[model samples]
Target: MENALSTVSSTLLSFFNSQALIAAYDVEIFEAIGDGATSQEVFEHCNLPESTGHQLLVAMVAMGFVEYRGDIYTLKPDMAPCLLKNGTQYMGTLARHASKFLYPLWANSAQAIRTNSNQRKETFGDERKWFDILYSEPNDVADFHAFLSVLADPFVESFLKGFNFSPYKAFLDLGSGRAALPRAILAANPHLNVAVCDLPEAVDHMRQELMSSGHSDQVDVYIGDVISGDLPEITQDLVHMGWMLHDYSIKTQKCILANVFKALPSGATFIASETPLLDDETGPTFVALLSINMLISSDGGIESTTAQYLDRLCEAGFTNVRAVTLDGPRTLLIGEKP
Candidate 1:
């Protein structure tokens, strides 16, 4: 009982850990220490007062993000890839997204739970749809998608390697942020025609990313919305929506699925990737937390069990519905047009 209470004690103070990391990112302390700088050098680099800097450094050491040697502090080697600005797997964008957007919304989680709705008005004084407010500014749009792209990198690699794409002649990715999946598909299966369908606001940014990534000539871009039925004439034999279904209420998810079903060619395959709750709804801890986060921050979004997802697919007139587990963060719920 005492041990359980101690765990509770630690859990309650966990926000301090998050805030410290955010503070480090905000002050450029992690980047300064990436090169194994001493406390004084880090303070100088970040323009932090020495005493506060030293205190934060000590806290970081205790948190295992930094290692304090006799004279120098260093980012823990394993964390450097994710924490350092120049690292290939940098997730500072996610940190920034959390700090700027999610954290404040989560502050009103209790209110969200009581009301069973998003807290956008409470947190940001905006009652707009989640993406409308989120994508209001260009920089906010970039940060939101950039962090998602980083998060999707593993899913892309795993999907490309695990899922068979050779049977399909053309592929369309709906709401494809950063175009990472379609880009990977193009690289691995060059013969398959690829395209991405997204909102008009995202088309320009996605086109730029595709162009810069050397896929402009190969991948097509389409402006469409799955919810409102403003869909492009999809000639693609396979359509994939990665990690998208959980962004809205169950009713909206069904609407999105039905619209996509109407857009696809006969005998086309459709896949929706998601991180869902377990069958018993016990825990895949992050996903459970994500469901709560969605409650507070999204448009009535909630995570589902794999069974719930497959049921939704079936309800949308999909045939041959099944689930595919990948070696990454998402599970692909697959169905086909009759």
Candidate 2:
């Protein structure tokens, strides 16, 4: 009976902690309960119906999101990952961005299916100008990069640990924003010579951070559009494309991959670290959430699965392909030329 009860309880908690639960947490119902609020108080605080609020509270308590003692309810530590404000493991953004923007746009994915068009009209109307928007608007740039960095955190040590970077004469980080990803990797591989390829505005920010880190000489700046601008023909042993390939359409991804394929010397490696969509073309739910965000935030990008990426790499004539997950969805897709 105890074993059965535990199994039943686990199922209930999983259901309550789903994306819907995060939305409730976003509205602060869990914290209010922790402050010794009643069901009616929770309803008033969250602007939800009293009957509905009571039901949700009951579920939350059963799921260990809240503990009820008579009329008072308190939040549980296990549930804090979604409820805590700005907590390190806080997953509230999944609900905040997922529900507010991607959810609505995803509701129209059927329209895209019917018309064979991008479901988001507004995102596509600007001719992929969202890149420029993210680049120029400092706040948005910082926020999105922080979001990406958080996603990359769990996987950092895996790829960082796997490769030795000292052989490289120089490192070129393509589409490097704030350059934090490379920053951490550089710390791990101290002898690496580094130069970031990004716009002038972004390099100004990168310079200060790099200089302060005592890497003023190890790291330098190259201002150019990596796609169209003239690239340095240095033939470095390692070039990084962290979290970048999924941001382009397959055609563009192939083009970019082909360019990098040609640029690398023998035994050189190209690393693309990102959350895996799925092995099949159909994505895992977490990646589906991000893919929809890409539709809304980017003009022409969607999260492609490992199969799709491998296809692009093979098509571009890079013979070696490997995928390894560090944790959860955070993964590395490494390709080497034969």
lDDT by residue (tens digit), candidate 1, 1-119: 99999899999988988988888888989988876999989999999999999999999899898998889898899989888877867777878889989999999989999999899
TM-score of every candidate: 0.97, 0.67
- Highest lDDT: which candidate? 1
Tens digits of per-residue lDDT for model 2, 129-178: 55665556554444455455566665665666666666666677876766
C-alpha lDDT of all candidate models, in order? 0.90, 0.66
Question: At residue 130, what lDDT does model 2 achieve?
Answer: 50
lDDT of 1: 0.90
Clashes of 1: 0
Q: Top TM-score: which candidate number?
A: 1
Clashing pairs in 1: none
lDDT value, residue 330 of candidate 1: 94
